[model samples]
Target chain A: MKQGAVDAVIRGLKAAGVSVVCYLPDSLFKELYPALDADPDIRTIPVTNEGEGAAICGGVFLSGKRAALVMENSGLRASIEPLARMGLGAGIPVIMLMSYRGDLGENNWWAIPHGITMEPLLNAMRIPYRVVRKEDEIETAIHDAYEWAYAAYYHVAIALSGEIVR
Target chain B: MNRFDCMEVLSAQLKDELVILSLGGSVDEWYNAAPHMRKASLFQQQLGCVTPQAFGLAVGLPHRRIVSLDTDGGMLFNLGILATLGNEQPENLFVVVWDNECYQSIGGPPTHTAAQRVDIAAIARGSGVKEAHVATDLATFEEHCRKGLAAREPYIVVAKVTSTVRRDIRRKHSDGREDKYIFVRHVEETENIVIMGPSEHN
Candidate 1:
């Protein structure tokens, strides 16, 4: 499930024609970064923070390009400002790939509160999201997320779990 | 060096071509005091990204001057931008680091910026800015700034300013996002916005 989830996410991004990705080095998505970095088809911008990454994606979108940001759920908190202010204001779509940190028998106690609050926070921001519990749902989630992004002109996040942890 | 006086010189010299990326807090005084100065962007204290963002603007536009008006406190957040700027080698960038020895934007909190003892200009010299200068006050600052711009190099000018914040001056005038969009659009719509060159550097 480990490499499988990675492959599915990469395939989904390629299928959607995502050309650039913004990321802040996160342990959860370490495996995916190098692959995308080396791929000549895509441009990867390593940002200092999640909010900056999100804002850069907004910029990429305004320039008429497709973009996605990879981050752990903790990165979600830092992104709220840019997500709400610019992304929502300009009707830019963002595909957020998040690693579920503190959910379903997770050990890290500190990540628990944020993990619990993540979905609700997205709801509060009115940014649509989905949880992809299995590798099979990856493509559908990404495709639907892109559609939602275009229709709503807002951010759409997908959480990978069960299979991701493997 | 008089901060206001140096700003006046810079404004008179480079206002036509460059947009300074200002930081939040007390540095607003120099920017606000000199309305004659050229237009600038992203003045809010978003910390550390302004330089890179300016570099990004420089790359995308490739036809305008991109100046980052940074505070030491803010610059410390992501110094890596220096290496990246040098690596990318965008010729249009001018990073002006205002080191007043405190986080004057947020109630003058001490932000061990550059370790106080470290000569930030020397650090910039080592960081590949290619042309970095440290000016103690307005006169020297104005002089160095002119030379840096005149040399046609990616420059870093570290101004050692006095720790001063005008309570009346606003900390932030534009939301970071709005500035980004407007400036980005400004670069895009106009193919050639840089009106002046090193010849005009005061």
Candidate 2:
């Protein structure tokens, strides 16, 4: 992740009233973690797994605040059950910022499945998301995701790709 | 001892503390014990989320006390949450696990706690939760609850309870969405923060 993209994402989160961020670090979002931790207004919780992050974000929402879960797309697979219980079972919204690991330019053989399953899984869970490839779209996509998630009481995902993740 | 007896003792001592209860017998028992407490949030779905959700609430609202009523089966499903809670170490959080040793809601199938001798409080302690203990009787359970409720450090009290369900005590099925709204409303009002907006009139 580029410094510019990190800054933009932070700005967007702050604008969306995201005071708590529950995340599991992935290679793709490594840069964003330090930036998130350094931000005085935001509290970053490094979770053991994505499912734990999802549940924590749900709790943050219940506490009358906004929270975001940041992780790799594969982490979404790990979080499916909790995500469903939160969004489908209980009308609780958890805004996610995920990295597109196995998209078009990927070379690692292990990552192909990540890209292959990300979109279909998101769709299956009925979570609306935006694949943000351009630098300019990063902030706006995150801002829009939080807005929609809170207003609709459902999840929204922002998948980073293209130059941003590279 | 029975879980409801434990719940009754805990409920009598609670004031302004937020409680999160896992699905199944605990929910019904809690509702029966403290129906008037609006600070309680009952889970109708998400079997393993009771503690993690409470952890999040504890983190978000550091000043308020968070009490989580979890079960042995729920704990077994998400044992990783114990590590997370231990690592985070939220001083205001207290977890009470009703170890009935079976999946009581799903027709009394034996859980790992029953067959394999899983010590949940020991697991919690090993996972980094400093104040963890197990109680077998009503007096010991009540004492632990009282200490946990008043303590500054986070506490995990696993009460060894029986598998018997009080058939006479029942609570209506709480809709998940309505439960979320009510819980959020309670948080907003107590914390003096705006969380939800009115639904648009179409």
True C-alpha contacts between chains kept, each model in order? 0.01, 0.72
Model 2 per-residue lDDT at A141: 94
Best by lDDT: 2
Q: CA lDDT of A137 in candidate 2?
A: 88
- Residue-pair clashes per candidate: 4, 0
User: Per-residue lDDT tens digits of candidate 1, residues A1-166?
Assistant: 3777778888999888788787776666678888888888777777667876775575455444578888888889988875765555444456798887777867777879867989889899887788878888998899889876765667889887665754
Query: Model 2 chain B: which ten-residue window has the lowest total lDDT?
Result: B36-45
Worst 10 residues of 1 chain B by lDDT: B193-202
Give the lowest summed-lDDT range of ten residues in model 1 chain A: A85-94
DockQ of each: 0.09, 0.76
lDDT of 1 by residue, B1-202 (tens): 5455556667666654545454654346655665543134434344654565455445444456666677676567656666555555667777788787777656676777536676667766677777888888677787777776655568888888777555665444555556545544554445443311123233
Please provide, for model 2 over B1-202, each residue's C-alpha lDDT reduced to its tens digit, 9 standing for 90 to 100: 9888888898888888898888877777787888766445545567788888998899888899999988888888889899988877788999999899988988998989887568998999999998999999999998999999888888999999999888897775657888887788887888888888776666
